[model samples]
Target: MTMELCYNPAAGERGLGDLYLPEHPEHAPVALTIHGGGWSAQDKSSFCGVSQFIASLGWAVFNINYRLTTIAPWPACGDDCLMAAKFLLDGEVPEFAGLDRCKLLICGGSAGGHLALMTGLRLPPNRVAGIISISGIDELTSDFALHSFRYEPFFGGEPTEEKQTEANPLQYLRPDSPPVLLTHWDNDQVVPVESARRFRDRGRALGCRVDYYEYSTEDEGHGIWIPDSKPHRLYPHLETELTRFIESVRPENPPCPTK
Candidate 1:
């Protein structure tokens, strides 16, 4: 079942989310799925298919919408994501009362992926089980020139060196960071593949568990998990790998067990 509710009622529509509940949802792990549109476009509807897929795996999925850069820039989008995650973890909404708060996982694509990394890393330690970033930017300053059009709007203009560092997900890496799954197509033109490689290497160097997958083919490009003609279809092995990662990161002493 799917229910649409406002996580932050003050923000109205932008704070709304579509929560997909699993068949036996009591104590089921929850996954927060964010949509990718360079942080300025798209909505939770863009992630409906992926959310349903996660729900099929027995995870209650909450696909959310955040204020676009057009309406608010810089930290606005990131704040919304963090608020959404907190809403779920705190059991603020009765519909999600019995879900497993300790095992919440965050997943997103492209710009959404960047937000996922930022949100998961910034949240209280051990609050997030894992993070999945697909074709997400790692360092904001490195590729600013190439993506100035998108980055400028999101950052409210050319970002200063300090602002860039603050926005870069790589800067938040630590030994206790939640395990991450990063996937990128080598031929990606939007967010270069090198960013993922760098993040994985840095995370591993810091003793953080980071599982990465690189699609060598050109066909997959940016959104490998979301096919154009087949929106519901996920790239081969994507589901298996995601399932494996989620299982590996399950909290040792969960708040409760599945009903």
Candidate 2:
């Protein structure tokens, strides 16, 4: 495996990303991993483990860092994610030139999960293949979501109802929206499992494909990073499900485009 540093100077100094490109990258699928820190803290390193796991599967992975609430607020984090995806899709980086655009997938936990949804929803249909959100917030309008605390710092104050509606990915589902894989722990103390359930239900209602997996609180816990968390025992299961879903959605032998 080889690694390269990718940054969008236009996005800002903090708008940096690390790309993990595997050998023999012909027609390789890609996974973009985002870290979760309530949108105020944490960095790309938080997802290093998962990124490496995905790359080990003969796929390219891009783990990215974006502006935190302390530096810029609300849409800044969301915008940075979109910029990172755009950077990859535009073939701005040589290391990722072998990526299969039609097989691109976005995966993240916690706050990163939220950004993945927003990014997937906002981007053009042809840009992304699927989404994997672990304990992500679906309804910004609910106080149980990031807007209660994590979101306030970014917004500079409370987001208006309209603004909340705009930020909520659950409210914008369409047939064109990418297929989603949602995994939520029943006992997640931060973001409730109901959020994931709502997203799954709504997506299905809109004729969008959504795969829902719910784990028990006693087994999985809230955060996948927690020590001895259920994630440890379930990593293999989760990865298998994710891989199957990706394979099911991606075209067989879809010729990868090179810049």
- Please name the candidate that would achieve the greatest lDDT relative to the true structure: 1
lDDT of 1: 0.83
lDDT score for residue 36 of model 2: 86
Tens-digit lDDT track of model 1 for 34-78: 999888898888778778888888888999999999899989999
> Which candidate number would show the highest TM-score if scored against the true structure?
1
Model 2, span 173-197: residue lDDT tens: 8987888899877788788778888
* Alpha-carbon local distance difference test for all models: 0.83, 0.75
Give the range of the ten consecutive residues with the poorest summed lDDT in model 2: 225-234
Deviation in Å, model 2, residue 102 alpha carbon: 3.7
Clashing pairs in 2: 74-154
